[model samples]
Target: MIAVLFAILTAFSNGSASVLQRRAALEVPHTDAVGMSLIGHLLRQKVWLAGIGLVIVAAVCQAVALATGPISVVQPIFVIELPATLLLAGFMMRAPLPRPVWLGVAAVTLGLALGMASAAPGGGSSAVHGAAWVPALILTGLVETLLIAGGLATRGNVRAALLATAAACAYALTAALMKDAMARLDGGGGAGALFTSWQLYATAAAGVGALFLLQNALQAGTLVAVQPCLTLGDALISVLYGVTLFGEDLRTGWWVLPELLALGLIAAGCVELARSPLASGNATAPARARRVD
Candidate 1:
């Protein structure tokens, strides 16, 4: 329960950061998108800096959640980030959310609750066992490589979806690595062991890689193309990692029905929310423009 609370807090923080950063990004010239000039411009924006600060806070909350709960449980809760972001954007912009947006939010909330209750993910080890990491890392790398290559070969929405999928995989891998590193501390290995673990460094690398892929995805296509893939892919892949690598137990057989239904609802909600102007980076557009075709 404590882990779930922290995960929710993390989602809220990340959602708020996304809205703030998007607002700040809109102030910069589009010509600056490709280089360090973009970062230089953003560094001058207080809104962007606040977003970065929230991102750091989210990371701390995520670390705490992973340390206390199964990765399967902690990571899936991030599916709410989209809904949270839309709601936050609406509140910040003083725009009343449309009916579909509210429905989407309800769907996501209910689906997440139903899924957690039905799946009951538990019995995972805090730390991964030896030799298990070898095959997992190799397979993950191969999958991400294929996704990135496919994304590079494509254009438009196809490129965005593929790149977002790659980013999702990297984010999931980062969470798994973070959990393993945090486990070292729980196991009485101390700060020395935590810093020395390869997983710690790998976590940082994977997180940065994920951020890069996500940025490329955003540039390639609309949120309709990237958001659902990013949200659902991360949750599902993280669950796979938890089950395979961390030995997290989830209900199977008859219980799979509700789990599948929950996933469907979550996916539908994500798609609906992603289509909204609030979630698609158009929250600041003129009301007349929003009302037009």
Candidate 2:
């Protein structure tokens, strides 16, 4: 329950960060995509810095959540990030959300609840066993590489989706690594052990890489294209990592039906919410127009 609360807080913080970062990314030149120049340009933007600050806060929340509960339980709750993002965007734009948007939010909320209840993810270890990280890291690297290559080979929404997927995978990996590092502390290891863990450094590296990919994704296309992939991919991938690497238990057999249904609802809701004007940065246009008028 404590983990759930922190996870929800992390989702909201991340959602808010996404909106601010997306806005800042849109102002950067497309030519700077996937390069140091992009970071250089973003550093000049106060909005992006504010977003980064929120991201740091989210990270702290996420670390706490992972330390307290199973990664499977902690990570899947982030599916709400999409709905949260749209809601925050609507608030920021001072736009009244339409019926479809509200319905989308309901679907996502209901689906997440149903899914978590049905799956009941638990029985995960706080630390991963030896030699497990080797195979997992290799497979994750290959998958992320393919996604990045495909993203680079595409344009527009295709590029955005692929890049966002890669970012999602990186973020999931970061969570897993963070959980392992936090375990050192939970297992009676002091700050020296925690700081010295390779997982700690890897987590930092993965997080920075994910942030870069996310920036490029935001620049590549509309939030309509990026948000769904980012939110859904992160949730799914994190669950996989939790189950496989962390030995988390999820219900099987008859429970698969509701779990499948839950995923469908979540996916459908994400698509619908992503299509909203608020999510796509269009809601502010009317506000600006009214101001002009």
Candidate 3:
């Protein structure tokens, strides 16, 4: 339960960070498609720096959650980040969330509750094997490579979706490695050993990759499309990593039906939320245009 609480805190931090960072990123002057200069520009923004601080907090909370609970348990809880982000963004944008948006929020909340209760994921190993890292790293690298390539080949929403998916995959890999690193921290290995762990380095690298992809995604298209794919992809991929790498077990048999139904509800709700005027940028267009004009 404590782990769950920490995970919830992580979700809140992540959602708030996303909104803040996106706002900052949008304020940046248009630049090259993908370059360090773009990142340098964002780094100078106070709002973006604040968002990075929240990201650090979120990472610490996530590490604590992974240390104390099954990765499956901790990761699935990130699904809440979507609704949290929407709520925070709605307030910042000063747009009244429509009735459908409220309904979508309810559906997502109920679905996550029902799904988690039905699935009951538990039992996982943090003692990662050398062989385990090989396949996981290779697969994650290949998939993210493909996603970046595909995203670069496209434009508009398609590019955003691909980049966001890549970012989600990178984040999932980071979390998986982070679980191992955090587990080491709890084993009385001392700070030196923790710093020397390969998992820690891998986690940092993956996190950087995820951040790069995320910025590009935000620049590519509207948040309406990018945010949902990022949210859902991260949650689903994290579950996959938890089960595959951590030896976690998800409920099966008759329980699969309800889990599927719950997932459907989440999907539907996310779609509805993504279509909101606020999300699509229509709600704030007049004000933005006036500022530009």
Candidate 4:
């Protein structure tokens, strides 16, 4: 439970941090995409640094959480972060967010939490095999690479959405692998165990690379579309990994019916809000329009 709590905290914190990071990224002016990213190299800035600091803190919290919880439990919290990010962003800088943004966040959070609750939090008959993760890790990497390539091949808002989705999927995969890594260590496995652990480290690298592309996507698109779509990626991936790789189960009883309904509502809220005018694909970022800041 403590692990779950920390993972939730980490997700929320990171969500808030990304808003600031994206805003900072938006501040750079450019004649082309490269020029915008290069603006920082040509000068100095602190906000993006602060965003990095938050990511580091989030990572530490996540690491500790994984050490304590099951992967199925840990991954859902990553979904919670999308809603948390909107909430955090308001408190940090973008106060007075339109109702739609809040609505989207709420939907995502509810859907994820309830979906996991519908599953067995702990008990299941099938066990995850240690060796199977090797291929899982490789496959995840290849998928992200394909997404990145595919996103690059697309145009306008669609490309941004694809990339952002890649980022969220990356984080989700990392969260799953991280929980697995922690599980291995708890079983009395040591550093030498991890050194030979190609899967764990490989997933970690893929996650990191995915995040890099996500940051760039944030700079180019509306948060409304990006945040929720990206968030959806986490929920779906967690569900996939949870049942197949982690042995998480589903509950079937009178209460389960309503729980499932509620989750659908949550997803509805998230998707509806994601495409709102406040975060529509063509909407101009407040900070991006200005040449000097």
> In model 2, which residue pairs have backbone atoms overlapping below 3 Å?
none
lDDT of 1 by residue, 195-227 (tens): 999999999999889888888988998777887
Q: What is the C-alpha lDDT of each candidate?
A: 0.85, 0.83, 0.78, 0.62
Candidate 2 total steric clashes: 0
Q: Show the lowest summed lDDT stretch of 10 residues, model 1.
A: 284-293
Best by TM-score: 1
Model 4 steric clash total: 2
Candidate 3 structure, TM-score to reference: 0.82
TM-score winner, 1 or 2: 1
Better of 2 and 4 by TM-score: 2
Record all residue pairs in model 4 with backbone atoms less than 3 Å apart, i.e. clashing. 15-85, 120-249
Candidate 1 lDDT score relative to the true structure = 0.85
Residue 82 lDDT, candidate 4, scale 0-100: 47
Error in Å for residue 60 of model 4 = 1.7
Q: What is the number of backbone collisions in each predicted candidate, taken in the order shown?
A: 0, 0, 0, 2
TM-score of each: 0.91, 0.84, 0.82, 0.72
| RMSD list, candidates in order | 4.6, 5.9, 5.5, 5.7
- Which runs of model 1 end up more than 4 angstroms from their true locations? 26-41, 285-293
Model 4 Cα shift for residue 162 (angstroms): 6.1
Cα lDDT tens digits for candidate 3, 33-136:
26888788888899989988988898789988888888778877887776777787778756677799888888888888988999998887865655887888
By lDDT, the candidates rank as 1, 2, 3, 4
